[model samples]
Target: MTIVDVPGSKSITARALFLAAAAEGTTTLVRPLLSDDTEGFAEGLLALGYRVERRPDRWLVQGSPTGPAAREARVYCRDGATTARFLPALAAAGRGDFRFDASAQMRRRPVAPLTRALRGLGVEVRHLEAEGHHPLGITADGIEGGELTLDAGESSQYLTALLMLGPLTRQGLRITVTRLVSAPYVEITLAMMRAFGVEVERRDSPEGEVFDVPPGGYRATTYAIEPDASTASYFFAAAALMGHEVTVAGLGRGALQGDLRFVEVLERMGARVRVTDEATTVAGTGTLDGLTVNMRDVSDTMPTLAALAPFASGPVRIEDVANTRVKECDRLEACAENLRRMGVPVRTGPDWIEIDPAAPGPAEIATHGDHRMVMSFAVASLRTPGVTFDDPGCVRKTFPGFHEAFAALREQWQGLAARR
Candidate 1:
């Protein structure tokens, strides 16, 4: 198989769309990723009355994220949490009525901190179903932002959501975080929002339990989406466990995604790491040295790290990842269960997990519809005997080329077991 270079992931796609829509003028996104979740986000903007057209390979977005100036519309966010979570605050800034709703799975994802923060911004939010969550009936006439207290235990997205919309209100917002984890995502939020048009001042407590986002709307501009480092973790694991070297390209030197730290994890675990402006290369050294790491910030990359753990020499322990529960699935538990089925020693708690290396066994991994779970463990099949993942198609939520890319890389691993 030839080395195939895939586009970025839907996480980058959705954020780019928000940034583009927030900016004025005809913004063209080149070589952009197209998928269910990103497509849903684009359509949500259309529902809010933005003119977005998708050509064969590029998206032509024409709108002034001043967002809906002439009218008000109600948007149902479906299962796109990026849309459901971020757009509400955007609507509040644009001074439009945005009724946010999601599918059963997305509805189950927590949105309380975001909603509470919006209310504190003086944007009235009504929960159509569960209290403090989504399918929210957002009636916005713009925010009279002042001070907001946010509980971001569920996810950092909540705080990021507030920061993105804070700049649009009359009194700019000051967000005080109650209990915040996954702080890197907030950094991502600030980076994107700043690119789009908003300026924010952030202050964090020692443990990251508290944060502040100074009130200001995002500034709009031509922003580029980097290749997803989180998505690249799977392929990195494949290269480190199997006999091949896999390189994922298109990320920049100063790329803002937090999951870019995956390289650090691989380097520490004894893989030879090579860096470039557009790509990352990881190769296995055959022998491994496991290490214990705190993943409170890079929790999303932990799944892929765990996938590679079974190939290590010592025990690998990951702690401070309670936020994994609010993601597309309960990532920590799912990773542990799948690893155990492969005969790896595993232990898990609410906020931590441990895995020991062994001769990996064969098992059918249940992905529980989480894309990361499917992609991470699929690479684990390289060193392990094998794994058949349920709902393998779940990878479409973030990466459509995952299985194909994983397969192509494995072709170089001289004695790789056959993929089903």
Candidate 2:
């Protein structure tokens, strides 16, 4: 059996790197995603005057007083949600005019929540073309972080965008989110905020939860990103569906990523999960039992669960994830539609979806040009042969070698089948 340390948490690494880029001095990122998202983010920083060193393993980012930058530049962040959402506010905070644009997918992606939030905080951000979308012309401006409510129903990036900007505001930002989905991502935001230097407090009341982020900038420090739990998820789900033992390395107990809680979801679904300081192990039970789960907090794991659902005995229902409508794609619909195409009994609605395992049939899968879709279906291929993807390279957005890894695993499975 081959052991693989799961890819580094792209979510955590990107968030940490963005925060580190704004700190006072040079910071060393121990393990960051060397993918397109981070590269785009670093390019954005470079355009805004931060010195970035792209190394073999780690990235060294030199931070300075972001008043005047190298030059006024335009940043095309591609389709990376993190770079698209986080860089705009940082560009504005640096008080330099920036023309921020993105790929067609990113153009369609919602940014109005963030622009509205920025406008409320007193930044002069205007859309060049679409009313609430990207292609923003941001004049160097700083806002007094004030109390405001954000409609983060689409994606948690809206909340995270503000969280990163709150501490940098002239006045600390007190934020109250309306229908804040992906609460774990917000928790990840808070954890990263606390790690860097922002002391944000959350209090519970009858009205809702309130966050008080003090007015300050992040502090530069040596930071390490945890292994990507979301990437490890497909492996774990494969083990559960195929009864193979899978161990994901480099994940720590105190990992800043809330997606790490995905191991808990696997456990509840009947996979035996063990967590150590260095790694997480999911021992396959050969077959997973169906689960009726609310994945609002861990929505990134939804596809993995859907892939594993066909192996379960009963119907699996995923709830509280309506926000999946605006992820890299309409993940809920995309996932459900794929499963239905596979002849699995699947039901979907505005916020929830149900998948009941049935006699598997032939289905040509559509990735919808989303990375997560590509990886989740790779897990399904182990159980059902003749399954191919529309765009396999989509995994490069997170893990580039995903299909290759699955191919290696399939070879061994084929060898075993030949002997049988």
Candidate 3:
């Protein structure tokens, strides 16, 4: 059996940085993802006067128990949405003045929901340029941490940021989630918080879901990150498309990422899946039956599923992923446009997309500067020649060596074909 060891999880890596920085002592993160987004997150922590030691195999972070050492600092989040959203909440826990900015692309994303929630929690946040976007000024004397209501329909990161700050609040924190999407990601946040020695009480209510976070801080500890399940989706999709077997090591049945559920989607579409303690394997059956899938909980793999749709025996309908529109690009529109470029028939709605199987020809796929778009569409290149990307390097956001890894997969596939 051949196994591919993918890089560590981006989501977990970002969360580890935030948790480690807020902990009381030194925390070591093992096998973290070293990419543009995660690096941006680490840099943001360093700017707040947190000490981070970067080693080839691990990262050591010396956290400030009271708060950030820097009373006032400016942090540039670059294109990392997690950094842009989570860091401000981390800043709120400290007695300091912070000015947060981001890249031009990140400036277009939404941060107002989180900012509004912060203001309700006694943090002073001002939007410098736009009302609901980045380039904000924040002045916080530490989180008061009382009951607050938040609308998390736009992005679950808002809820996650607030939840992470719950244990740091003066009065503890009770959050009423008005509109929640991507509940699984919140599960990840809760899980990580518990790992850091904080417990959040959760219950389902008529208003929505309620969380009670006790007044305490995180304890520093050693944590190991799992391989990225979202990035592994492309290779899994490759197996489904080309009737090959691909196994991603370091991601097992116990993986924390919700995107690992993507393999279940492939299974429902007639692909074979085997998940063990060591690794998860996806083997194609040379036949794909299109099916309707709701991707609300695992929306990150929407593009990978869309790429595999064209090779299916029937149409694939993906629903409950309107949030994809708010990602790095309007992913729904980008997927539609790219499918049209490849001569595939596609129908789209506000929160759903139906892709009909067709013989896609050679075409240049526009990536819209989204890393997932580039990696997802690259899978189509395996079965259809002349498939190219507009900006392949945009994959540096998460997987800097994506093109090289993809080439290795192709070589492996060719070797398998020669054996056949």
Candidate 4:
């Protein structure tokens, strides 16, 4: 079996940075993800006057319960949605006049739900440009938090931002989420918060899911980040499509990422999947059975599945991923457009896409500057020669060495085939 070492999770690293900054002592994050998005998060923390010492594999963040040391700061969030959404809430809990902006792509994404919740909790939020979009300013005098309601159907980051901000408030926070998508991500947030010393009370009420966070703040600790399961999906897809055995290190049945469930989709498609306490492995069975799937919780793998659907024996239908449209790009349309370019039959609606089985042809995939787009289409390149990406380097958003790693794997698989 080909064992691959995937990078640390972007989600976990971002949440850890927030937790470490809010805790009472210095936090050491072991194996934190190093990428444009994550580095941007550390830099945003520095801009807010939080001390962050970065090394190759670990990050040290000094916590300040009172809030940012810089009374005035300007943070460019780059293309990371977590940095854009979570940092503003982090700044709001401190005493500061912080201005936040993002890349043009991130600026187009909405953040009104988060801002609205912050306003309800009495934080000063100003939309410098379009309403509900970034390029916003937070004039903070510290949060005296109480009860508030929010709609988090568009993105779960809104809820995560508020959840992380809960302990920093004077009265703590009681959040009632009216609508929530990507529920598993919220679970990750709760678990990480518990690890850092705070426990949030969650219950399903008649109104919605209520989270009661107490005011006592967090205590810093050493946290080891798990390897990214979303990044592993690409290599797993590669093994399935090419009939090879691949094992991803640092992920198992007990892994926190909901994206790890992508192997279940592969299992349903006739691949053999083995899960242990320490790792998970996928082996191809030389047969791919297409089926319908709902990927609301693990929607980040939608593009990976879309890229492999053409090789299946029947139509592959993906459903309940409407929120994907508002991601880095319109993912549904991007997948359909690229598949059509490869001369594959595909159809899409507001939230679903169906792909008919075919031998996908050569085409130049439009990356749209989204990292997932580049990584997903790279899997399709395995069987279809001449398949290329318009912007292969865009994978730097999450995995800077993705191309090199994937290429080495291809060489190993080829050598194994030659021996066989």
Candidate 5:
């Protein structure tokens, strides 16, 4: 059996940084992802006067329970949306004048929903340049938390930021989510918060969904991050494409990331999947079935599914993924455009895409600076020889060693084919 060791979860790493920084003692993160996004998150914490020791294996963070030591600071989030969204809320927990800026790509992503929610909590938030975009400035005397409502239709990060900040608020926080997308990510946030010794009260009400967070801060402890299931999807997709077995270690049936549900889609496409306590394996049956899948909750894997769709026996229709349009790039359009470039016929609507199976030809896929695009199209390379990428290095956002890993897997697959 061939096993791939993927990096730790970016989501969990970012959340751990936030929770550890806000906790009252020292916390150690075991085997956290060391990628651009996570590095940006750690940098943001450092800017707030939190001490983070980066080691060869683990990260040690000294908690700042009373919030940031520096009253005024500037945090540059680069292209990390999680850092861009979550750090501002963390800044609001402190009494400071803080400015948040991001890379050109992240500046285009929306932050107004989170800003509005912060305003409702009596924190003054201003966009230094654009109205709803990045380059934001916040003047905070700590969150005067109260009842607030926000729409999370554009991105779930807004709700996650608010939920992470809930425990630090003076009056606690009562959040009514008007429109929630990627609901599973909020579950991840709540679950991690609980692990950090904070419990968020959740209930479904007539006025949408309500989360009541009491005013009790987090408790610091040693936390181990799970492998990124989203990154593992690429290896699984490769298995489906080449009729081989690909196992991703450290992500299993009980993984915290909702993207682990992506294996269900692979199973629906006629792939055999075994998820145990330690690892998840995907074995292909030499054929794939096309089906309609709604990937709203686990949208990160939509690109992987799109890459695999062209090789399936029938058409694959992916629906409820409009939120993908607002990600690092217009991912839905990027996927459709790249698939068309690869000679696959793709039809798209505002919230759905249908891909028809066709003979894929070699094409240099434009990655649009989105990491998912770079990684997804790499799976297509296993079947098509001439599959290349315009910006393959964009995968450094989440998986810096992705190309090397993919190459190693290809060599292993070829060796197995020769032995057979």
Candidate 6:
């Protein structure tokens, strides 16, 4: 079995930074992800006058229970949605005149639901450029958090931001989420909050799910991040597509990430999967079966499945992933377009995509500057030679050395095949 070590979780790293910044005392984060999105989050913290020490293997963040140190600052959020949404909420819990902006791509993405929720909680939030979008301003004395309803249908980051902000509020927060997508991420948030010394009470209400976060902020501690299950999806897909036995270390049945459940999909598609406390393995059985799947919760792995679908014996249909449209790009169309470029038959709707079985040919993948697009098609290229990306380096958003790492794995697999 080929053992692959993926980078630390981006979601965990981002949340860790937020939690550490909001907690009392210093926080040591071991194996934090170092990439454009995560780095941008750390930099935003610095811009807000939070102390962050970056090391080769870990990160040190000084917490301030009251919030950002800077009274006035302009935080450029880069392309990270966490940085864009979470930082504003973090700033709102402090005394500051903070203006936030982002890249053009990020600027197009909506932050309205989050901003509106913040406004309802008695925080002064202004849309500087477009309503409910980034390029916004917050004049905050502090939050007096109370009951509020939210719609997190387009993105879960809105709910995550509010959930993280709960402790910093005056009266604490009673959040009633009217609609939520990607529920597993909320579980990660709650688990991490418990680690940092706060417990959020969750229960079902008539309206929706209710989360009760009490007053008194978090206490800092040492945290170890897990390997990114989303990033590992590419490698897992590679194994299933190429009929290799691949094991990803640091991810087991107990992994906090819901994306790790992508293996179950592979298992259903004829791969032999083994899950244990230490790691998870996927050994392709030289057969791939395709079926319809709803990917609303683990939607991040949708692209990886799309790239692997053409090799399956039947059509692969992915549904309930409409939130993916508002991500770095419209992922459904992007996947459909790229598969078509490979000369595969594909169909798409508002919330689903279907790929008919065919041998994909070489094509230039248009990445739209979205990192997942480049990485997904790179997996497709393992089978279809001469496949190239219009913007290969866009993967710097999550994995800076994805091409190099994937190439190494390809070489290793080839050598194993040769020996066999």
* CA lDDT of each prediction against the hidden true structure: 0.74, 0.80, 0.91, 0.95, 0.91, 0.94
Q: Name the candidate, 1 or 2, with the larger TM-score value.
A: 2
When 2 and 5 are scored with TM-score, the better candidate is: 5
Residue 387, candidate 3: how far off, in angstroms? 1.3
| Model 3: per-residue Cα lDDT over 1-420, one tens digit each | 457768999999999999999898999999999999999999999999999999998999999756788999999999999999999999988988999999999999999899988888778899999998999999989877899989998889999998888877888899999888888888889999999999999888989889999887999999999999999999998988888888998888788888999999999988899999978999999999999999998989999989889999999999999999999999988998999899999999999999999999999999988999999999988988999998989999999999999899899889988998
What's the lDDT for candidate 1?
0.74
**TM-score, prediction 1:** 0.90
Model 5, 102: alpha-carbon shift in Å? 0.5
State, as a TM-score between 0 and 1, how close model 4 is to the true structure.
Answer: 0.99
Candidate with better lDDT, 2 vs 4: 4
Instruction: Tell me each candidate's TM-score.
Output: 0.90, 0.94, 0.99, 0.99, 0.99, 0.99
Measured with C-alpha atoms, the lDDT of residue 156 in candidate 2 is 84
The total of clashing pairs for model 3 equals: 0
Per-residue alpha-carbon lDDT of model 2 for 287-368, expressed as tens digits?
Answer: 6777888888889888888877887878889998887788888999999889888888899988899998776666778988
Candidate 5 lDDT score relative to the true structure = 0.91
User: RMSD in angstroms, candidate 5?
Assistant: 0.8
What tens digits encode model 4's per-residue C-alpha lDDT throughout 250-345? Answer: 899789999999999999999999999999999998889999999999999999999999999999999999999999999999999999999999
lDDT of 4 at 92: 96
| Candidates 3 and 4, the one with greater TM-score | 4
lDDT of candidate 5 at residue 174, scale 0 to 100 = 90
